[model samples]
Target: HEPVPTEWTRTTCPYCGVGCKLEVGVAGDRIVATRPVIDAPSNKGHLCVKGRYAHGYVDAADRITVPKVRHDGRWRSTDWAEAITLAADGLRRVAAEHGPDAIGVLGSSRATNEENYLTQKFARVVIGTNNVDCCARVCHTPSAAALKHMLGTGVATNSFDDIEQAKTLLVVGANPLENHPVVGARIRQQAQRGAHLIVIDPRRTGLARIADVHLAPRPGTNVPLLNSLAHVLFAEDLVDRDFLAARVEGVEGLAAFMAPWTPERATQLSGVPADAIRRAARLYALERPAMALHGLGLTEHLQGTQGVMALIDLALLTGNLGRAGSGINPLRGQNNVQGAAVMGCDPGTLTGSVRLVDACQRFEAAWGVALPHKPGLNAVTMIDAAHAGKLKALYVIGYDIFASLANADVTAMALSKLDLVIVQDMFLNETANSFGHVFLPVVSSFEKDGTFMNSERRIQRVRRAVAPRGDSLSDAEVLCRLAGELGFGDQFRHTCAEAVWDEIRAVWPAVAGISYGRSSRHGLQWPCVDEYDPGTAVLHARRFANADKAKLEQVDYRPTTECTSEQYPFLLTTGRTLHHFNVGTMTGRTRQQLLRPTDTLDMHPYDAGQLDLRDDMPVRVESRHGEVVLPLRVSDAVAPGQLFATFHDPARMLNRLTGPVRDTVTSAPEYKVVAVRVRLA
Candidate 1:
């Protein structure tokens, strides 16, 4: 048996974006136990199964301890010296053969702000290219882009604590109970306390079942549904005229745009009844202090950015901005997803989400290098470029593009053509196993000292709970060594994560005041610009009154390419469950796998009955892109013509069936709506 833990370290949970504070028990170099922190602000004394049991994955059997280099098409473990040298040489050779624009770098949400910030800098300064993007491109990039464009910042206007004070809550495209348990628990508890709850989804989610008003719109019709809701607010005179007169502009333009959308018309397009739309609108409008929370359901669609803006428009229409119990908030999927974008890991942005070209001179002065001025390709576009032989090299940092990308079969073909593929992660993921030329093993979050920004935009400390498993290093350490090998080590001089954070603080205005010295038992929310600023909880308080009044843009809904036909009758949607995280990389190795060891495709009982399909029957689900066979789950949770599934189990390869239909503005994939045909094999 393990010896009794003599020491304990406080850190944030590294699973979902709920950011539950945890205390990990340690004896010497081993972590023995973990429990929720009683006074933690986000998830006080509450933990889901993942937070409770997912720590055992750090010592997983397949963890890569040393770096490996592919020689003669075979793998051979090598020392750090040869590994870094080999990677540097390959990158140089690629850059020499095909210019800087031919290289692309992909960052991961699993990494820290310091690591991601440095990764982008390495791409811009060392490689002399802006071809860097993060996992958010496939996840919440729509939220960030739409929110930033509509509002001043690309984050939640209010804090999570607002859920308690809200008299009415609007949850869209999210089943918090399954995906984010702590937040779900609180939202569910609010309903039990007699708060009016409204849930909007195609299928009846757990919260939707208990909600006072549940609006089920057809998949891919979020625009019509939301526009119809706004139309009701306008037609019934439920909008807050005083708030609009004082703080908003472009009303006439929006009025003209929304004039054609009536609840009846929305019913025709979205398959939802007019009565339900009006009822949900009144319940949300009449209720004082109404708050909204949404997840990937609002995103991961072709009109994702517009849909987000529509959701924000409702809050704005009701005067919900800058209030305690009422505002728009996004529910994130991964722990550091917000941080990846905040750190400016995208091709077009620099630290703090500023346009790279606008900040080029400033960065060049600081780092002593002429930064890349032109914007480069995003994640999806990078893959397309690689497939077309335009991109020659790719750097994947802790992300499994082969498993996460839409039409992953095409991704495999694209990566095979790369001259060099460098992968950095704890394990050899699908992308690494298939096309990796150099592999650098990295330590887990439990063995690294850094920080993660939660869904609520709170920055918290992540202390090292245990020593690294073997010769594995933190991502920051690996990047620093690689920069030294490639020349211009002075520009990337960071001995530790804290040192990297210092540079981040100097560049990113939102996080300038968040020093490691600050007490982190309760993490600090951003827009903490100076040393003495206490940090902002709710934004746009007085600013909407003065020159910084919110601008109301006229946005219209557009349809995606995924249209159901006689050949492909059923619509497919994707999401996660309570027991696992994305791609099942970490949780699969832990005891959590026992809870859910495989994947299943959920079809409504009525749909299954038509084909003589029973529960747990194997079926082949084929889409326009690819196909996968999964056990059928005859569930009433989905609608008659809609199906649902989770891609947590990678072997299922559900993404293979999803094509590259993405949002126009942010390029977020339309994972929520697809046409597929199912049959018994």
Candidate 2:
């Protein structure tokens, strides 16, 4: 039954970490108007340009309305039944020939909680292998590992609303204004209210404009800078002695270890002034309450896990945890990144960030699947195995790995070599271009009912506003149908998403208090373990995860894979724009493209002049991995010898120059630093 008429339906924005609630006005099938939902908490009445206008991409010309199969070297439209049969047979063939470890599934950050949950479930249960991973491995995996090590929980300790009460705020690695607009707006208001602002980044971002101390350190230098800050606070006796004695452990061990990293020694490595480091530390410690907020700028590097650990070290030393205004928060890039990870998206871990090998007995009893005891390969490892002809099939959901992975040419060849490539997405993407056997079209956010966990670990409801487009189905529906087709219908018989959520909560204690009914009243944060418990906002208030004991791990910084030489003297970094989302899958067809199209490689004036490059002039940036020709835009926002490029454009192939020099612990690529020489084309 089709609806007669409706003014608007409340929904959530499909862009950024802010996750602003929106009112999608519907006349018949199309969104006639979009406005901010005034009653929502994240953004009361404010909507960014991306949220207000980027919805046009939903109805774009190239949307994959039906399933497709590659035939005669081109894609041909096909029915979903035939496509699924072909995909299933192909998966069986790959498994028979190459083994269970040869098949892998790639999850997405953009997917619904149910979709992500089902995808991982299928990978673990049906595939009989642990080779299941997601986009979180690239961005927030380091943050998760670091937080779980330092504080028992990986979720945000304080809510974004708590910025108003903070006395001092330290932002590192992220440019919130461009990446997270609404959250940035709130922090700006906090700054206006006399809270001390300290920003540390390689680039001079919008947040830096109003910051009292903006430490512009060199790329890949965050570890040293943070250690130096810790050193200053400990030497000056500025650390909270009472908190260290009562709440923390291993303080004496950490203090003795970091005695070598003085302000003068760290200044040489990070290129930040010694005075600035000392002043910032003293101010943050002396302030009533201070917070450390981070983004991908901190976690998408060679030493990302260690960098995050250093930030946690600072927070613990200053006694900033478990408070109203102070905690270490990683401003998540996509909605549900934290939730997806918490729900067991990692191949090596189970839900609640528990190691797979350790928790297999408990999970086996709960799911009745005799889960694999050995940990599996991560995203980067799977790609490498595929290229080596060890892996044969890949089932990608929601994410465009062809663009997200490092080294575009290598990734393309790897995909081409696969025996079966199944892509589930709303659009026919680059991954579907090379030898894919099946494509499954999934529902958009407006066409679905589920929940999304925001940056603060708050899970909110996302109700359906419109019908599925043209026989298309929601991801959960499709996965359940696929399970039936694959002979696991009885086991996967979930009547509703609520059933799945409840099962997950019963097995995993972190989300014990999260339910559809509880979330409807108000979004519930995680670590809600009891029936009458309200979800925890800030964690590690009194003690750390290791039984009230936080152990400091010693780590050292390593330069990126591509280092500066005489020929390639510039460091090229890639990130997002204010108007675009990842790979422009959603934002490219919008009015924002008319506002700004094509990719721009941002470089400082000094570097541009030295390289004989001018604004809007085509320049070739060459790295050891690959080379890309792009128009150069000289901007003062970037520091000298540093170049920035947007990753949304496929033509630019910004990822060609980025390869994997993974962190030792977390395996996150160093997308922030790669040496490239810029020359006029």
TM for every model, in the order presented, reads: 0.98, 0.97
Instruction: State residue 93's C-alpha deviation in candidate 2, in Å.
Output: 1.6
Residue 533 shift from truth in candidate 2, angstroms: 2.7
lDDT of 1 by residue, 503-590 (tens): 8898777788899887367879988988898888888887742256677756687888898999999899998998888888898888
How accurate locally, in lDDT, is each candidate? 0.88, 0.82
Q: Count the backbone clashes (under 3 Å) in each candidate.
A: 0, 0
> Clashing pairs in model 2?
none
Lowest-lDDT window of 10 residues in candidate 1?
544-553
Span of 10 residues, lowest total lDDT, candidate 2:
1-10
What is the C-alpha RMSD, rounded to one decimal, of candidate 2? 2.2
Candidate 1 — which residues are off by over 4 angstroms? Answer: 1-3, 544-547
